[model samples]
Target chain A: MSEAESSTAAQAVAPVQVHYCEVCTFPLEYCEFGSSFKKCKESLQKEDPELYDKYYSDEALQAKLGTLSLEAQAKLEKEAAKKEAKAEAKADAALKKKLASQVTIKRIERNKRKHVTSVHGLEAFGVDLKKAAKQFAQKFATGASVTKNLQGQEEIIVQGDVSGEIVELIEEGVGVLKGIPIDNVVEVEDKPKKKGGD
Target chain B: MFKKFSPSTDISGQTSVKSSVQRSLRTNILSQWKVDPETFDQIWPKKEPITLVKCREHISIYQLHGEPLFFQHYDGPLFPTLRLVHKYPFILPKVGVDRGAIRFLLAGAHMMCPGLTSKGGYLPPADSGLPAGAAVAIFAEGKEHAVGLGVLKLSTEDIKKVNKDIGVETVHYLGDDLWAIQKL
Candidate 1:
């Protein structure tokens, strides 16, 4: 049989054991036990002792004790529902966190973009600045320099300061290096960088 | 001999790698420099761990006064391969010449491999008593041996011949120290 088909058959024929912890009935052995179920029972007991006592009575439990105690059974189902709800809540929280991180990161990146582009009328290429600078230096024969500051971040420092036409040439050079559309330039006050690239 | 020192910023004109970029630049030069393939193999051997950390950015030069002490107590050759990068120089503290990593040194030979950073997790103290800041890879085939990238004043052909005699490939250069692979 194929791998998928074999797996399905194996699963169908396999003896699945549900592990329930003796004290808490927590699902211990990889969800085989009922730790969560006991947790539910405890919560119910804490929330309303009178309801817990009524539901957890020996006689009532004995009636449905074929597979599980009535109280334990109720507890397991309640726990299952709570677990699904908890998982959904967690997923929602994670999504929100991810979006917030992205938004913050994008904002910082956008702010930095202004500086790289502003000085030389060149937009930030953002692709391994050192490599790009090396390539640019080779092509333009302008002896472009790549430096890394104390912080281990890389930057491409191209020569010649310009405003209108000179700025356009530099921008063109940058475009040649980055192979991307040049955005508008904005000034950046960056610390003098050191040199390094792998 | 009076200790020779230079300002770390002088890179364009300097031939000898400065103290700050010594360790990294040495490794890079050794890795990049011209060498025959067969000779490269004999001088420089390949293994899992890339012990040398590349620091081509900024180097800080210093004229150290005293010798660094290794964890082990042996007086052999002291090949100084000392240089620290810009701000991150203080990443690992130096007890003497040898900096401590994940594996805390128990004795000269025995080390507990905690395997913390995937570089085998532990390092025994260097047998060489010198305070050389060398990146050594200690492993066992039949017995234990150590290999690291070091800086030596040997030419390309000399390095190749050394590798041929040593029966390994490629010499890793760590500024001023030739970390020749050798059986301990």
Candidate 2:
């Protein structure tokens, strides 16, 4: 189609908002189409009649286009804003929750603290195995309950009210040896949920 | 004086030789790697063919100091050749290692290939180490060699953010249960 014809077709297709002029390709806001864009329309027709005829004028072409009504557009924008606000609020809530739940000590001191420990058997498997064990230990620590087996081996039962965070801490302890990465030392003992509701 | 009967013990020595041959055949047939029946037959044309059944019958538990000893599988003898820990050894989730944790990595290293060096991956400038949601650092013991295994704690959200930001599944928990900082 001719440039003018194409431009007209474009205008007919979507009348909502045009950023750039279909003909000149200059930004519509910069073009004469600012405030009351109707004047700009007249100016365009006067400036380039031949160009306008090729693209913009005539009812010969059927502009088969869909557009959101003002109400619909407004509703869409409102919904978008609501979604954004909800996301922001959720993020804020999460941050606040994190801050609130953090274990704060007036002073950081090293004191030997004792808790029930369940250390997994030594596994010669590679780092992946260690990581897997760490994850399992974390899961076991948080969600699962713990019991002592007849054989004296501590058994961690990942069950009701158990969480993933507790398991993570347990795994962290297991992965270290004098602050070095160690293999397969997941220990768990039944205790009250440390933080966060079960 | 030494035994003067050379011929008498000579035949016994031959029997001992036969026992050694039998042991050799047993080891070859009973070991993990199995040779083709045709090849076995060809190799032992003169001796009786030791089929899988015969091999099993000949197998004996080799013990050392009352302990059953098996061959130690070695990927390689050198520490450098040895592969680091697999995807997941212990069950930890969302665990990540930071530059500080990477005391194992060498100090002076240059970018060689993809993933090996931070030069190409989304490693942030040397000031604060790479930022969150950056690409995975695949260090191959370059200039900054990893001295030992370094551990880092990461949360599930952190992992998800990294994956989402990187536009790919870079870091994944090899195991269902993931170990994190909490337990550490």
Candidate 3:
């Protein structure tokens, strides 16, 4: 190797240099266990602007937070406020127009002698299945279960057709219980009572 | 090992849902699995609604296209009908075990960690660190077939620490109620 390269190599072989905080002289990494980085930055900026400026480099990726003029900054803040207000209003309107959501309840004729009432699409109203299922089973005096359908969607299944009373039950209980939206409830099946054939 | 399994109760009712209900159910399923909502309905396809019933002992009975498919527990994991496993095993998370462990797995005994930490069997990704109470499908080494569903009793780290018995509760074995649910 060249003489200069050999000298640099020897230097590289020597003990690794330890970096310390510019303001406190404490090691930077271990600062977290001590006063921390923010304190050091604040102290440097307050006590020694010249050192802080010397240490700061705009070219560094960390130092690249852009500075905006007062008017430009105000305009951006106003736009953000306006967008947030619009979103809040949109949510309020959606919540007010609860009847507009796509929710459907179906009554399935399970077999020859029995009826299975399935309440689907209630998730839109934020209905908790376990509680709802238990309530339905008690209300109708039939077994009820919260289960995922073929498509992995959660639905409440109650034994027998309480379809007519079920809708009213859900609507009335919506307020007392958590998360059953009154307006979002719709019955897709309203068929007349079937003959109790064995 | 088990001589018999908990049985499935036949659903007392019948259901024929609407075309719109079917459409929304498809959308709901796709959304739950986080598949693209915009994917064509024809690609996923629609089928006749299944016969469902509440199991007196378990959560409920599941039938797909009018055939009994799965029996899920209320507070615990599901006992999948082998017919369901026979069709779609890809969707399940899996654990591997050696040929020696396969016999115990079929007889419905819990899978110990010894097989998994040994020569033939291997672990799932260690970085994720399989947590307790998570369900996994057991697939035999070399056979490449899912034998059953299991619930981990302990965390993967704990399993690695102890080299002996009962790492996972065998929820649904190949020859258990899940395997026989299809015939009924």
Compute each candidate's TM-score over C-alphas. 0.21, 0.18, 0.40
Which has the greatest TM-score? 3
Task: Please give the distance, in angstroms, between residue A114's alpha carbon in candidate 2 and its true position after superposition.
Answer: 9.3
* Least accurate 10 contiguous residues by lDDT in model 3 chain B: B34-43
**Model 1 over residues B1-184: C-alpha lDDT tens digits?**
0012222222223232344544543354335332223332332233311122111233222112221111111221222232111111111211111112101111122222221112222222344221223323322111111212222222223323342222111122111121111110
Q: Write the per-residue lDDT of candidate 1 for residues A135-191, one digit (tens) a residue.
A: 556655565565553465444554432124323444575544433333433334343
**Can you tell me the CAPRI class of model 2?**
incorrect
Give the Cα-based TM-score of candidate 2 against the true structure.
0.18
For residue B15, model 2's alpha carbon misses the true position, in angstroms, by 56
The clash number for model 1 is: 39
Report how far off residue A117 is in candidate 3 (Å).
41
- On a 0 to 1 TM-score scale, where does candidate 1 land against the true structure? 0.21
Give TM-score values for chain A, per-prediction. 0.26, 0.26, 0.49
